[model samples]
Target: MRLNIKSSILFALLVSASAINFSASVPDEGMFPLSELHKAGLKKAGLKISEKDIYNPGQIGLVDALVRVSGCSGSFVSPNGLIITNHHCAFSAVQLASSPLHNYLQNGFVANSYEQEIEARGLTIRITDSYEDVSKDILDAIAKTDDPIERIAIINKKKAQLVKEAESKDPSIKAEVSEMFIGKTYVLFKYKTIEDVRLVYIPRQDIGEFGGETDNWVWPRHTGDFSFLRAYVSPDGKPAKYSKDNVPYQPKKHLKVNPNGVEENDFVFILGYPGKTFRHRPAQYIEYQQKFLLPYTSELNDFQNQRMLEAGKNDKATELALATRIKRNANVMKNYRGKLKGLRNIDLIADKQKEDKALANFIQSNTALKAKYGTLMSDIDKHYQLVFTDAERELWFNNLYTGIRTYQIANLINKLKIETAKKGTLAQKNEYFNKNIALVKKELDAVYESYNVDADQKIAAHMFAQAYNLKDKNVIQTIANKNFKSADAAGSYIAQNIANSKLNTKEKLYNEVLNNAATLLAYDDEILKSQQQFAHEHAPFNQELTRREGVLNKLMGDYVAVKEIYQDKSFIPDANSTLRLTFGNIKGYSPADAVYMKPFTTVKGIIEKGNSGDIDFRYPQAIEQAWLDKNFGAYTLKGTNDVPVDMLYNMDTTGGNSGSPVMNAYGELIGVNFDRAYDATINDFAWNESYSRSIGVDIRYVLWIADKIDNAQFIIKEMGI
Candidate 1:
């Protein structure tokens, strides 16, 4: 029988089957905030530490040691601020410090002394110092706004004012306001930004990125994907940029390394910032992502990867420069592929549809709810359909500007025109021009460093062809119709213009355009004209998209409010790049029939997988000899002669959780979380116990390599191993 709202509403709402179950019997899921851990069933899951041991604003604890390094997570392993994180997390910094003669990326780096540590340009580490609820403040400020846009503006103004006030209280503090629980909650986080980060140690590509793309998200992996960095501060022990006078930062608390690696079903928890998730989104959104967004993104990424590969061949400089870009593109491509497959396998759309139907039925059966939320689902669905109608064109337009250099140049030109129109003194105008010109030069230099004219031309041609072939008329089609006989003709014309344009050279740009902004503004440039026209035509669609998003945000917040009031179930806020704690056991599962994956992988697997000539499988001769000789030190697991490489757990995690410290029940560091299993990629939308698993590099393997291969005994001694 269909459930009647009047008779069964409370019972049905009390038990949220879709949410993470807090019972000990269920697989551990949910990225919970540190403040919520005390009430989040941690004790039932065998936590050995108190709530204050994980986080206490008044005192230093585990959260204090956890630092936001670059865009990933890392933890201080020593009081002097020796940080341990994933090698991929430090890839860009290593690349920046590397050159043809001193290739730190190909060969590993180890600092024997503090002075040997190299400066990592443009790298920073952030530590959260305090947090407070600001929900009441924001809600009270926006209580009178009936219009969604006005409400958003008021909320933004209040948040900005709060952050500014908080930051003004102390020079060392950087403040940000975070919206949580679908905007039902607001929290202001204050961070101490340490800007002088340095590279301490990193393994060679062979060990750090051993499996490469072949085993990126696969299980039973042997990748030793961990690196060490050190944070530095000014002589007065304050945040500052990199300098020789800086000293290593002394953190109040750092994690103790536990060489005794985890065994099966052992309690494990991770504390770090998870990037983002969309688990609370409606069924229509999921359908759009699965059917349209992922497919489109996957195709574009695949094309970019191919172009980058072709451009990198036989060119060492280009190869080195494009390595990070190639890796990023390939990672996203693989992720989208996995997400697409997982969505189909899990039938998330159908499940969401069922849930939506139940929600609709309940609302319809109640007089008050029927009046308030009767049209909510239909409204959202209609807006989503309208947005999807122009999805292809919007995708093409956005990506074309980012992918092509000419479009970027055109944007700069447009910006200069705007700035020129402003009333200012002659000196002020020149100063503005000079500043903007310098920025343009920097951007152009970066573009030319990795830019391949031929590859870009091919990409532009393909993009034009796709855009022109679409049923709807877009700016690309209009441009082609106005200027050329076909898409190929237009592409060739644009490519030639990019090749011959004076903007290609920085000196020309400065002398010709910077000093003569008015003349250039009046000059005829096909690309600039097309871009301006495109922006003009695209404004209406962009505005509509923004309006729909605002409406959705308000409706979703109201839905969350209703659910919280009516349901007795606990709800953890979705991830939004904030520090969170997720606990689970060291266990494994079968991804397919007759295929059971063990919880841990060992160095023996690495030996078996190694091939002498292959880049991904090859290892150093000394490392292979040490493995063959069975030189397993105290870092080896108990009752086993082999060293553990990587392990899998059921902890909930996402993108920014990479390099997060995986600790035992005692709050001791045991491993570093890096990637998720291929089948678990869909966890961002829906986490399934049967398939979801997070992969971490065992800390023992890291020490083993540091001792045997790198002979970095100093680091080991510093960590008290």
Candidate 2:
């Protein structure tokens, strides 16, 4: 057997991490040693962990309290079984569960009890208990099939067999035999999901998203970013739908809110589903970001923001509706700019490359194992090298322009007009067009607003002139012009035409053209109807993604096979969506020669950024004054409001991870991990732990938002001190 293929691979790597206490008694890193950490940290705190310390998180009782609200990790804080998570985590559900009169986000929502709690369709929470090491079985089954496609089929067949076996027994539990680190390993994780997870409490959008996109990533955070919800189970205690008879899901254990509050350097914890971070990326990627991507993106954001603001200043309603998209893109632009500058500093990335090469050499030492996964590691790097080049990112950005809301609307209007051609009735036509006329108006202005006509037309002309192979620019422009909202009529002109008898050919559209107020109305949004789900879902793109997965998986399996044979520590790819833990000390690094961000920030930093008029930097006046005047000695801000929060932790997380908890060994609420610094944007592909500080909006701020700020007593009480 190759050295890399040997079972000793994992043991050797642990030694390399210089992980404290190399004994078998300590739990493995994959599961995060939650129960062990609780036992160790709690006892040290003079707290005891008894059988009662055990938690039945949804259905996985074996998981300790630390898993609570982290990602399928939460304790039943209330006797009624309430779950707490970041407000953004609840956005999708809140969007789904909301109504015209009962918007969950605009005004904070609270369901008095379970029955009234809105069940947002398809939102699910699952707890896993049964995990079987099916690595050997799976690898053996797929060994002969070197072709990636065949290998995927073989692996899937094996996984299906395992799932079939599990279903025959429990029937209720969903059995998933999945690959970890790609096909290099397999784990059969059985989950008992609670489908009836309900919304219990959500803050008004003003508070939950207060400072909105401006305050999203940057900290010294006054953002009131928390929400509470619960899961309900049937009387029988198995997973069931919402019913009057069901009971509040009893969590493994609920966390103490620490209203007495967190102190600087106190052992604070955050347990929530953290999206993802790459702490093992190469330094070259970091350099590429600082040199190319950051400048391009920052320029792009500035250009877009200025154009949108200029076009929109004279038009308030036009700005109001489209500002949402502009604001979001600006946020990404800001995040990368900050992260790129922060990550480019030598301390985080220079040493990173040194470390990466060491891991590469470890693979080289084990000849037999190297033969299997050695190429896998190199190939994985190769894929990224090929796919993540500067040109590729530009290509990706160009693709995004196609999906812009303004662009989509232009196309939709033409489709609607074609649909109504032959149908004819004056009153019926008036009603139909009246419903959609606002869309046409918005579409017309939106296209013009998207870019200066000369610039827009020039880009259109340039794109058309320069391209070797091209699609319909004229069609796009045609849709942009006449079809988009009566070709520029004001609100009054539209109002008078609804009843006019002069036009009859397309009465439906004529009516809409006449009656549509310039502002958006209910029928204007497409998400209202879930049709064309296939085109919307983009079947072909998904098919390509699946094929790419096979390539990626084969790359994964080979690495594990070689690493195991070599008896080297197999570097597990950072969690794609499963659980993962990354640890680092609280420290600051040089942004350049003279610029050093002390590990934390003070309220003063907020004031500085505010006066600077950095559009991305937001500090509401009331909150800004409160922080400046308030006592924060107990909280350390080494720089002005730029303090490093607690160490970030969570299961796999990604784009949606904004405002997640960064828990510690204690499983208590600590800091909120908001955004990663930009220079390491590529870190999502790999972990370069040095540069990656899970940027957190301190818990002090969350409590501050609850108490001093919004002063929502209803919410503070629900935290259930």
Candidate 3:
């Protein structure tokens, strides 16, 4: 049944199902519980998956792959620092370097020599290497303090000291050195970075991302989701900025793309940040997601897609802007649906219930565990209900964001200030202004149109009526058209209406802005002043949070120590956003016995989904022809034509893991993580151990696409295959 209504419907009656029993009608193969898979992952990560090993190699492998890839997460293939990351991670650089004459996204980019590569923007990656048992210091400090503010403060200061001490020893390491999972963990991670990065070679969109958006986040599908770029350093063998002289960063080990594809259950392993899985969430939270939130996100995404498609038809620029938003939202929607489906699986939920019962029984005798976490399930329920109550409000708030004009007043001031401060004469200033006039005009235009001067009055009316429990269509439509207006008339109308509104908040911030337009426009701006004020107020809050963040880290470690059970594959929440490692054999599963999945994908799948000329869809005749010519070697040939182009490996990972490299037990790159199973969103709160599939584009296909399809020899040479 499709849940195609307002989210309010959830308040009347919540759907009930075994948390694990819901399946996508995937035939139930003899399977382990969600808990066991996580346990398996922890063990592979080289941690004991128990309290005793919390300080050991806990999740180093997963952490290694979970790195902030500078611009994006990447895997360190060789000790020499040869890094492999996503093309999108490098997209900003491509954009910066691109021009009317050159479009990197369209034509792709390649650097035959190392010195020519661009250093991407503000990209940095970190990995956790150590953690201390600071539980005693934290408890003692908190025990001595009473006020929440002061207690939080003291905890933070000490944490700073600990991080400093930890990171000071290593020149290359960065320490977030702080807390996680509700203030109970601490960790220090190490990292290696290359300042001089070079673009080795990238194929045209037609070959690089063959299927593009159409094939995105899909399975049982063929899509060559791959790109190649190289890391470089200076002649001094030091990481250097882009210059005339630089060299490719030799890596620890780069995985040779095995054209001979993988078969079902062939040993495979993925080392990447498999974004969240709620394998641990209580039934109430999962149920809420399944019943309401998932549908809401999907509907909202659909609306966004509709708007983008409309924009795409006439305005290319508008289409581009909306395209990014829609693409992101669509992924979210896809995951929501996938998750909902997984959550609805009857067998999956049953398995979860059985495991939960077992866990409860195991903790029944542990007094401390019982006292501290026994109520966790109920707490989870409480939190879920609390969040649910505000579902509509959240939607309203999110929707309001569409009305905001970015730095509407402040952006103009900055530009004027820049023009005012230039060293040149008025003539020079005029020249600069001339050069920038179109951009400035474009900015203003964006604020005016995008802000929905009416603040979505039409959508607002529909929502408002629902909130007030009114059901009159005419009244809603009348209210919408009546409230909204063009930019010129909006200020006066809003100010007057806002002051009269019995409905608006007393703060009346928007009203104040509208009422005093003359003064705001005459001087710098009131909006700008407020922005500054907020920034100042936020500093102390930010510092305090950062400080207490450390204290919470140590405490969290202790918490995990108490919860870590070595018997099964289990996940621990990430702290300090550090890179983690998870290890598991490359294995395929029977979502049931009738359906067995292979661990790799083949080119044949791409042929099946081939499009004649979908702009976003790129399958070049050359690539297809290569396949028709029986171009694949034994390495490329998996036993089945249905080569698992994409494989869902069971590994615990989370958000900061885009483009993370997935390696095998032998430390070979098997795939690059693109996303997590939709059902895994709950993984942020708990590992839905059942839906713990880490989605990655197969390495073999990535190589195949580059070699046979794209016919780029430079990339192959640099990859050192």
Model 3 Cα lDDT, one tens digit per residue, 1-721: 0011122211111111211121111111112211123433334343333412222233223333333555346765544444567665555445444554666655777665445455543354333334334534455666665454566677778778766775687655455544433444333333454555545455565555556556555544454445555556677665566666776554433454444444444444444433334443445545666666788667766665554566556754444334335555666677676666665654354565565566666566678768756654444444555556645544433443342233333445444444544637655655565566556556554444332212223333333443343233212222244444433243344334333432122123223422232322334433344334434544554464444444433333333344454133223443224434444434444555587655455666666666555665556676577777876643354445333457666655556566777664344566777655444544454443354555677766666666665555555565566
Tens digit per residue, CA lDDT, model 1, 1-721 = 0011121211011212342222223346688776556656777787898877887645667887889987899999998989999999999888878887888998989998999999876578998777776776787797777776677777889999999998898777898998876545677877899999999999998899998998888898999999999999999999999999999999878999998878999999999989988887778889988977889888987887788788878877767777877788788888888999999998999998987777777778878978987887777677778777877777877786667656676777777766765837666666666667667667666665556655666676677667656675334555645556676776676667667666555566667766654554555566667677777767876776666666776777766655543454556777888888898999999999999999999888887888545567887777788888998888787667889999999999999999999999999999999999999888889887889999999999999999999898888899987
Clash counts for all predictions: 0, 71, 95
> Which candidate, 2 or 3, would have the higher TM-score against the true structure?
3
TM-score of each predicted structure versus truth: 0.92, 0.61, 0.65
In candidate 1, the residue pairs with backbone N, CA or C atoms under 3 Å apart (3 or more residues apart, or in different chains) clash, namely none
The Cα error of candidate 3 at residue 671, in Å, is 3.4
What would the per-residue lDDT of candidate 2 be over residues 1-721, giving only the tens digit for each residue? 0001122222122211342222121112222222223323333432223322333223332232322232333334454556656576566567656554665655667665456677744467665544555666777897787576676778888889988997898797877765545556566656667777777767666556655555555433444556667878897778898677888766554555543333333333333333444443445445556665666566556555655666557754444433544665676677776666556444456675665566578777877646644665566667556444433233333433332332233345534543443347555545665666667656554443333322222222222222212234212221233232332232222223222312211333344533432211223322212113323434454454456567777764454444443443334344444333333333444434676545555445556656766654544566566666764433444434432222222122344345444544344445555554443344454434344444555555555555555554555566664
lDDT of each: 0.79, 0.48, 0.48
- Candidate with the greatest lDDT versus the true structure: 1
Q: 369 in model 1: Cα distance from truth in Å?
A: 1.8
Better of 1 and 2 by lDDT: 1
List the lowest-lDDT window of 10 residues for candidate 3. Answer: 10-19
Candidate 2, residue 207: how far the Cα is off, in Å: 3.9
